[model samples]
Target: MDVFRLHFDIDGGSFASAGNASVEVKKTLRQLGVSNAVIRRCSIAMYEGEINMVIHADGGTADVEVYPDRIVMVLEDHGPGIPDVELAMKEGYSTATEQIHNMGFGAGMGLPNMKRSSDDLKIETKVGVGTKITMVVRL
Candidate 1:
């Protein structure tokens, strides 16, 4: 099949709509006949990235490319960049505010879950600038 692409504008600070992009991507993968396991992995990774963007950044853009052999998800945001990726990658480490914690959304598991769910993960960030995360799931 030819490559299929999807784009979404994530509304930052909108917890109510946080997982919309991932849900749409999941639906599209199912329609494309992607395997359940692959779809689940992609969905989980995408959802985590989307949540991070909503909680940390003001908003962001998510682009997904579905290929015959793999699905690529790229999430980019203009929020404050991660200071220490290594620390952030560790489970249970987060900088979310108390309000975020009270919302039951920030457990510092976003990056870790994204890493676990994707076949490959790449992160690019600049302090005070923004962050870009790329994740791939084999199909």
Candidate 2:
């Protein structure tokens, strides 16, 4: 199959609309006959990334490329960059505000869940700049 590409503009701080991109991607994958397991992984990872963008970054962009043997997701944001990647990787470590916690998010599982769900994950960030996350799942 030819490579399929999908793009979405994630709105920051919009709890109500979070995960829309992941949902759309899941639907597209289903229409393309992707396995449920793979779809679930992609959806979970993408949803986590989307939530991170909403919670941390003001907004961002998500891009997905679907190939015959794999799917790649790239999430980019222009928010404050993560200061400590190692610390952020740890489960249950978060810097979110109490307001965010009240909304049922900011549990510090976003990055961990992304890593657990993706076959390969890469994170790039700079202090005071932004962050970019790329994840790949093999078919």
Candidate 3:
């Protein structure tokens, strides 16, 4: 069994740079010979999280740990925090402003998509403090 770890900082308030970390991770996974399906699932979930960080929070940190049997990703941010985690997890329920929606984002699918793609997902958020999300995928 082997383990590989990776880290990235998501820049806040930059739509253009959002999801870049996930893109890099995807490339790294490909180079590491990870399966396409697994890589795709991870990338999709990570990308969504990255976008959320940019849109909702003022950027965040992404940590990925790859093990022989599974992969885990942790995303942490110190933003306004989620007022209602359950509501935030709903699809098509957005708290974004008109500007974000105008940019083709804030469709409110990030958390839901992340849950769907990962084998396990955990979210810790404090109102007015921040949020931390951990997602795991089986290999």
Better of 2 and 3 by lDDT: 2
Give one digit per residue, the lDDT tens place, for model 3 in 59-81.
Answer: 99999998888889999999988
**Which digits, one per residue and each the tens of the lDDT, describe model 2 over residues 1-139?**
6899999999996889998999999999999999999999999999999999999998899999999899999999999999999999999999999999998888999999999999999999998899999999999
Off by over 4 Å in 1: none
Distance from true position, residue 51, model 2, in Å?
Answer: 0.2
RMSD of 2: 0.7
TM-score of each candidate? 0.98, 0.98, 0.96
Best by lDDT: 2
Arranged by TM-score with the best first, the candidates are 2, 1, 3
Candidate 1, residue 16: CA error in Å?
Answer: 0.8
Clashes of each: 0, 0, 0
Q: Is candidate 1 or candidate 3 better by TM-score?
A: 1
Error of 2 at 35 (Å): 0.5
Which residue pairs come into collision in candidate 1?
Answer: none
